[model samples]
Target: MKILVFSMATIMKDVSMGGSQRHLRELLFHLADQGHQITVLTNRRQDNSEEYELCPGVQVLPILRFKETFPIPYDTHPFHLAHSYSLIRQYADTHDVFYIHDAQMDYGYLHANIPTVASIKNFVYPEAMISAFHTNRNYLIVSCDYMYSCIQYTVGRVQPQITDQLRIVKNGVDLSVYKPVEATRKSQLGLTDDDFVLLFPHRPEASKGIVQAFETVRELKEKLKGPLKGQLKGKARVRLLLPRHFDVHVSKETEQFYTQLTQEAKEFQVEESLVFYPWVPGHDMPQLYAIADVTLCIGQFIESFGYVQIESIACGTPVVVSNVGAQRSIVPSGYSVIKVDYGDTESTVEAIAELASTPMDITGVRQFLDQNYNYKENLLGYEELITSAGKGSSSVFSNTSLKSGSPMDVSYKLAPWCYVSGPKKGIYHDYFYTYLNQHELYSFLSTCTEESFSQMELVEAGVSSEAIEKAIEDGILVLYTP
Candidate 1:
């Protein structure tokens, strides 16, 4: 299938990246390798070269973005921007399906002329998603079980119509590229044989627990004062590997929070225990995950799916995360993974110390998780969805104008092939079946001949939108136009 993925900023990977960007980059790579003709559309400043690492063989098109105006704050969201709808509409007729990475983008506000699938990453602003339930060619994709439930709670409540269009597609990690400890982060950092590295790899935001992590470290280091059995060689002291940095798209609030964290770190006099790594190449993430004895994620916000925890576990790194959002499911208690409630400094420290005490072999950790989240398996699942979506785009509602030469044409009836036929079931499965008054419906179909349904006729029949959808799905009815 010819697929088009739309992302506002650069589709990023490797370096600490936002969840949506990472998801898109992974999807592009997986699908392109699967032989789909994929095109990535992005918004980046003018450059001499047009480069795309994620979609290696595909073309990356630069698009015009919404300009920030005075008085009104700059809308960084691409979907809400002026050109987003028009740009997407331009390509709607060409692509087989549209994969929009963000759910809150304004595109869903209008109907998609092409088969459109959107991944709802986080809690979308309600206003930005107006008319989503009624959107055409719209289908929703969720990565994890938690993500599905989160979207059901956040957006589903507002637009109940979305429930019918959702599909669960779990996130997959590339074992071939992200496999266990091929290289040591300790060796790269010049850490002595006796030092333990606790990696804090997260966005530079308060919600991400950047400061909370530092505070936890302050308390943890104090708690682990005694000798701790290191993952390697001998007794090892906890040395944190956290780079105080964020990419360009980071918010001003986040930058200020980072500054505050720096001040707090300086005040704590814990700089000696910190090891800062310079600009890390994107491909070195697996190595970084491998080097850490235990990856720390003490964020306070709700993570739809914690990718870092998955990547760390894949690299044979014991991951200890706060029991918040989807972290509990991602890093459930068992194996080498441990979860602590946010703000519980003592438990968080103890969890880390416990993992450090008895070294969990990198081989064992990798072996345990080898079958859990396979990238190829999930890629096939996505391909099935995309292909099905493209195939389903064949159906549309269309019609020709009806007229009365005598000026007495107030009557209408069902279109051709649609009739009071024998009972038809909704969807092949029984789950979507709506218990319609098939007798009344058949009577209505056989008798009604006055254009479309009048408000009175619909109300008298006690028909619902779902029943109508079920009727359409069951092939008891269909439109000449939609």
Candidate 2:
């Protein structure tokens, strides 16, 4: 099967945009090896001329040519959606199945008339998009039970018809890379075997709890640094591997946090407890995880399935995670995944301090990972999703359509297609059409009086404001007031 993926994930050892991209890349390579032809169209921008590091069988291309981001969020960004549509238009018809990463691109694939397998990695998918796909029942991929619940509760409110398409394919880790190993590379990393490393192998951002990590370690430095006389006792130093820049396209808010973190690290004297290394390569992650006594993955964002916890546990390291339903849902029973309140630095420090004495259960954690989070087994699940979606199976990954809960206002309606007869022409009506998409048009229609629509709507929908005025001149659409 030829799969055309419209996601910003790379199968190569290049810059990553976090877990979603990493999951896609891992699955794509494995699927490529399974004899499926894979092609990825992502936001490489310009100047991303580095070679793709995957098998020669897979093809990767950049959807956007220019570099830079729209300052606003995705909900109102027409420019970003236009770029997505341009990419979808380029290859939507040619592929056997469309695998989309986010709900913002639903309009692109819906019109393409192809079977789609979309991942609802977050709970933020709009009701308009969810309702749009009610007729076709596209496969909505979810990574964990947490996100599955989120989709059920949120989208189910606006569209009760939305639940049937949802499916769970739990996140996986390459256990081979994450398993415990001798620190042959310890000295090379400028560390002794005796150092009590507390790794936070993620981007240096506020939501990632970098601020908390610095504060927690700084507070616990004096307590953990004493010379010990035990089986694994050395000068207890907390070495943190924090990436300088995040792998994804971050806004100024996160950029400000990043800038502030670097400056305050010295002020907080975080270096005393945690040795901060910036931008460590992915290959070195296993060693870091193995060497560390405790790892902090206290991200504030609601993670559908956090890779840090999975990888840490797989590497036989105990982790301190955000106290939330999302991260908690993935942890196996009897496994100690320490939870800390979102911004409670004192609680986080206590968790770390408590974990400093407990030994990592390498055998047990690996068993948990193998049983649940192994890449090969979960890749098969993904392959099944693609093949089943291609076969048009209503029986997706789950045995039944999902259930629902909380009310999320994903309020937008798409305009229905209309037929105007004047010697029937193409798929569309005989003459001029509205500039806005169904969601945008209906939203405008909601705000406008019954007698008239606004020129701003037309401009927002990619038509110039003058287009409506010109259309009125050409007798395309009559212009009047309510």
Candidate 3:
């Protein structure tokens, strides 16, 4: 079968965008191995490469950029949607099935009148969720039950109508790369045998709980300085390893948050306990996971599917995860997975102290992961869905007419706010929330209402191109036809 995949983001190696991208890469590799021809039409990376071969035979084309205007976030953005429609018209005839990576991208596929299967890897916006339910396709693969529940909650009572389309295909990890391995980076990373290392392998986002890790470490230090000092002789140092950056797309707000976190750590007198680890590419993540005594996935960030927990467990590392979202559903009764409440600092510290002395027996967890979270089983689930979506499809390019000069095509405007009664200094939409200087940001967006500014015009207005680019990526400033 010939497959055409449409996504806003797809990377071959450096997976800084997290598990969703990895999930797509693995699925395409599996399909390619099974003799299906796959071509990916995705956004260009920072380096601006035109084409790539993800594998030996699978082709990846970076052609999803907004050509007529500056790029914006992908959810129903007119430029992106129109661009997607234009591309689908070109390739719809040759591909057997259209595999869309995000539910928000369903608009183009729905109107194409072709066999389409979409994966809801993240929380779908209300607009996209409503639009997707109006589709004629039968297959809508959600990553886990949590995402399914989110979509249902977003759609309210009418969810029953779309229930037939929502299929739960739990995320999986490749055992070949994530299995138990020797701790090869302990000494190289300046760790001694007496040190207890906790790998907080998450982005520097506040929701990912870097502050919670710091608080837990500070409390652990107090415990060690007192009565617990004599009990654990060899465990003198407790370090929480946090990566500095997840990707090159670090926003200014993230930088500010990270800076504030470090300052707070110093104020709490726990700066020595925090070790900011360098960025590790996705391919070297197993080695990074192997060096840690415990993996921390505790935070307010509700995961659609907690890939970190399963991936850490797959490497024979015990995980302390928040009791929320798919993390709780995926590994309910495993000793390797210790669940704590979102902000329970005392409990998290206690859990870390207990794990410092005791080594977990991950045999049962390994067996469980092999049966459920193995990549092969995951491949089969998606393979079945893709094949089913392709069955009895005979027409393509059936609906090529689009709103060519619609208001969404001419200029740029502020995307709709997800919350109107919320804070005035922040932009909250989809999965991102970044506080901004109201005077600087609001004035710029207000000016955009009059007319779109070119790159030079923006510079002349004293707005940095970086700020506009960031706003575009954040969906705060979007392409508008008028």
Candidate 4:
């Protein structure tokens, strides 16, 4: 199969820098290995010239170059839609299946009349985009069930017709590159053999929970101050490795945020415990993972599926993740990974303190990864689905259903607040009502307004707006459909 993968965020030369780029590169490589010809169409804004690279059977075509004049979120670049459309049109002659990364590029793919597999990387905007693209006959692949459910719930309330296209394909990690490294690499980074390093190798953004990790470390240190011995002492010296400047721009706001976080860590008197490193080179990431006892992925928002946790597990290190989205699915049971509820500082502290002493079974961790998170196996599953879809099969993937027992449910715990419906939008009101009660969850719920609801198809099976409104009037966290 000749696949044209369209991504607005990927710059071919900087594959290792961003999650979307890394995912594109890895998937391209795997597809190429399976004897499929792959071409990538992406924005060429990083440099003035349009560049092309031929890697084995895979080719990268950079087109529609544009420069940014002001600060904007990376995904919402104005030039994205125009650039993506022009490039896809330019290469439309040879492409087979169009695999798009983000929702913003749906317009381009729809214009091209391409049979696309649009993968939802985040819960936000996916519902709206899927609803808008409902008639396009595109397969909506979600990275995790958590994201799939979030999309279903959000879209079901507004545009229920697009639910049939929803499918779950959990992101996989390349173990060949992210596995355990030599002992010498640890010494090179000034990491002692005895140090219990807890890595937070994401951007220094507040939503990524870098600040929360620092605070958790501070609290843990304070709790261990008075005569806590042995295992607790190990936890007290917990090292936090935070990567500096992962964002495209180091804006004034970002600078202030970083400064404030650093100052707060200093105030907590655990400044020395945090180690700041420039973004780890793609090749050296395995070494970084090898040195860490636990990798922390504590995002407060609904992360589609965090690749860092899988990368950590691939390197034989456990992950301590905040209970959100697909992260829970990625770290399976009986593994070295631990899960803490979102925003619960005390639980995070307790998890870190406990893991500091527990001996990690490296072999067991590797075995679990091989069984669940292995890139080869996971990519093969993707290949089968893509191939089936290309062959005009009604069921492209066997487990396209976003039900809880699907393989995509690996990191996702059955949260009572979320539910998945078919490709057509249908509300699961029971879960929505429960989710709205929690103050934090309620904030996310409130974001769903009548305008948003207009995007989904409301089913008669769902709780009526009148009933929900009455519940809300009675001070209950009820979902208002309108």
Candidate 5:
């Protein structure tokens, strides 16, 4: 099957640098191995220049030109959507399926009336946006059971008609690329022969919990002083490797935090214990994971799914993650992975100290990856789903079926009718209100007619003259007004 995948950015050379890019690279390679023709659409920037060349069978097409934006980085702009629509329309003429990674591309493909399968990554979308896309029989793929549940809840609340098409496919990692490396690479990164190095290899962002990791390490170093002095004199050495962009905003804050912690270390007389490395190349990540006594991912918010945690586990490196979001699902129940409650600094510190004293079972970690997150097994599932969707039977709802009013009534019926004000001229807010008010509630009373729902309706309430129009141009909203 010829498949077109639209992604914003990817890091093919460095598996550790970004999660979405890594997923795209791994998924494309695995699919290509299965003999499917694949093409990727991404942005053209300095980092992405070598992006398409990383994979052999996969073809990379740059859709837009833009400067790099970090933290929430990408090359997607409003103009890119217009360009993508034309590109996808041309590709859809020959390609079997259009697989989209983000919402913008989903909108573009839906507008072109192309068959699409979209992976839901975020929770929020405008009601008009939902209605416009919901009419099309598109397949929605989610990463985990948790994410799938969230998508179901949100869609059910806003646009339940489209819920039937939702499917869950957990993300996977390529263990071959992430497994344990030889000690020589560790020495090259400045680790001594016997030093215990703890690595925090993520973008130095506040949300990623870099400061919390540093605090945990600081506390662990403090607690180890007396035991080291008395039991193993001259045999204790601990360091931290924080690879980050020098210009990244959080890097300055991280450096400041490191300075303050080092000062505290001096006051506590343990200053010789911590070290910092600003940025490590992506290729060296596997070695960094191998040399680390423990890898930390202390995220405060819910991760859609964590790639770093999986990457660490794949390297046979033990991980300490916060008990929030997908981290719980990503790490197996009895593996060397340890989970601490979010904001529980004391517990986090204790977990690190415990891991330092006890060695993790590397074999169990590797075994977990082999069984669950292997690239081939995961990609096969995606390939099958894409192939299935391409055959034109993958839609959960059809307009004809929805119009028949069995499942349609259940999906579209709204409880407790409410009045809507405007899809007034020049005001998008009024347009949405009027659209929901006129079509969603009134049009469903009799047999559903697309004309009645599509046309604007003028209604009078106590004090307002509201003009109701559909939110999405071709989409209809059925508001239930009592």
Candidate 6:
């Protein structure tokens, strides 16, 4: 099969460290190994490269239009949707099937003739679900049960027709590469055998809970000097291992963010316990995990799937994860993984302290991982779905097309998830599965009609002139014509 995969993540050292990016690369390589022809369409790196082979066979064609805005901020910039649409239009004809790594950018192939399957690897943003429900061409694939549940709650509630298009494919890890390690690189990392090392194996972003991790490290230091000191073998020293440097050139925003993080550590008086390290390549992450006493995955970031925590467990290390989002589903047995509430510094410190004396049950944890999150099973799942989707249909979208009319003559109605609710007059955007009090925008949408109406009719119907224009601009009122 000739497959075309679209991902914003480039095949670069800095970008490949992310879990979703790695998942895309692994799947492409696996399909190539099975004799399926695959070509990946991704953003060009800032350094400006055209095309390269991701593996020995799978071709990676980078879209040069994205070079200037390499890390396109989708929320702030319009290029994310525009570039995605343009890219799909340019290349959709040649490929038999389309696989998109990000559901948020799935707008491009909504009306494409070929089968398109897109994956959701983040907190189920409403825009993503809305895009999925708006089309029949795309199959919304989620990585965990939690993501599936998120969709089932919002979109599924409004549009039961989307049931056939939803799929759950669990994320997996390579056991051989991320296996148990008998020895740790303590001496090399300038740490003793006795020091309690807690690894924060994530990007140094505030959203990733870097600030909360810093506060926890400070509290851990205080605990070690008190009653918890006896639980350790030697001197009670707590080290919070953080990845400070990166392989790619740091942007001004990133540099400022890191500097602010460091400043916070100093303010908390835990600067002494903070151990900053340069970036470790993805291949060497197992070694990094093995050396830490407990890997910290606690933070404010709503994880779609906890890959770092799973990898830490597979590497024979216990993990302390925030009890939120998909982290709970990673280890159902709760064998080697410890759950703590997000922002609860005391519980986080205690979990790490408990693991100091009692080592993780590597044997049981590895068994659970092999049975559930094995990389082979993940690859095979994608293989089956893509093959079935490619052969099943020639025309993927519904027959319905927008009726051609003037801008004001286009029919507009409330989105399936959107409606006016309660005795109060307001427009609700069910994007987050909740009603928002948008009174001004509600004015026009409340008067929305399934049948076409001219602008003069809407104004004559007592709809505020400002509300009508705002509704059209915000997409609260959909139109078939420009």
Top candidate by lDDT? 6
lDDT ranking from best to worst? 6, 3, 4, 2, 1, 5
Model 5: residue 148 alpha-carbon error in angstroms = 1.6
lDDT of each: 0.59, 0.59, 0.67, 0.60, 0.58, 0.69
TM-score, candidate number 5: 0.69
Task: Name the top TM-score candidate.
Answer: 6
Clashes of each: 10, 1, 5, 26, 16, 0
Better of 1 and 3 by TM-score: 3
lDDT of 6 by residue, 40-129 (tens): 777665553667776776888776344333233353446655765676767778888888776545554443677877777774445454
220-303 in candidate 5: lDDT tens per residue? 666558644422123366677766454344335556655665566566554565555655544456877877877888766556
Give TM per candidate: 0.71, 0.71, 0.74, 0.75, 0.69, 0.77
**1-482: candidate 2 lDDT, tens digit per residue:** 87877653333355455666667767777888889887777654434544464665677776443233322224435786677667676686787777776443466344346677777565432532453344343677777766664455445544555656777887778877777776565676677765767787775445566777777777656555442233234444556655554433444665776667768888888754445454544556777776677888876655657888878777777888865437655785456578765556767767765566677676888788788877787889879888777676653332334353321211222111211111212112111232222422333433434443445445565655564445444433432211
* Worst 10 contiguous positions by lDDT, candidate 4: 407-416
TM-score of 3: 0.74
CA RMSD of each candidate after superposition: 14.7, 15.8, 13.6, 8.8, 12.4, 10.0
Question: Where does candidate 1 have its weakest 10-residue lDDT segment?
Answer: 425-434
lDDT measured at residue 411 in model 5 versus the true structure, 0 to 100: 30
State model 1's lDDT: 0.59
Give the per-residue lDDT of model 4 (tens digit) for 1-482: 88877665545465355565577676777788889988776655544236566468877766644322112324445666555456577676566777766544555444344566767566444433443344354577767666665655455434454566777776767667877886456565666655668788886557778767877777766766653445653543667777776443534565677789878888877788877766655667887777777778876655667778777777777778876556656677667778876666887877766665677787877777677666776677667766666666643222232333432222211232343222232222332322333332233233444322310222222535454345334433323222
Candidate 1, which segments miss by more than 4 Å at Cα? 12-16, 46-57, 66-80, 106-111, 124-137, 182-190, 226-236, 244-257, 278-282, 361-368, 393-482
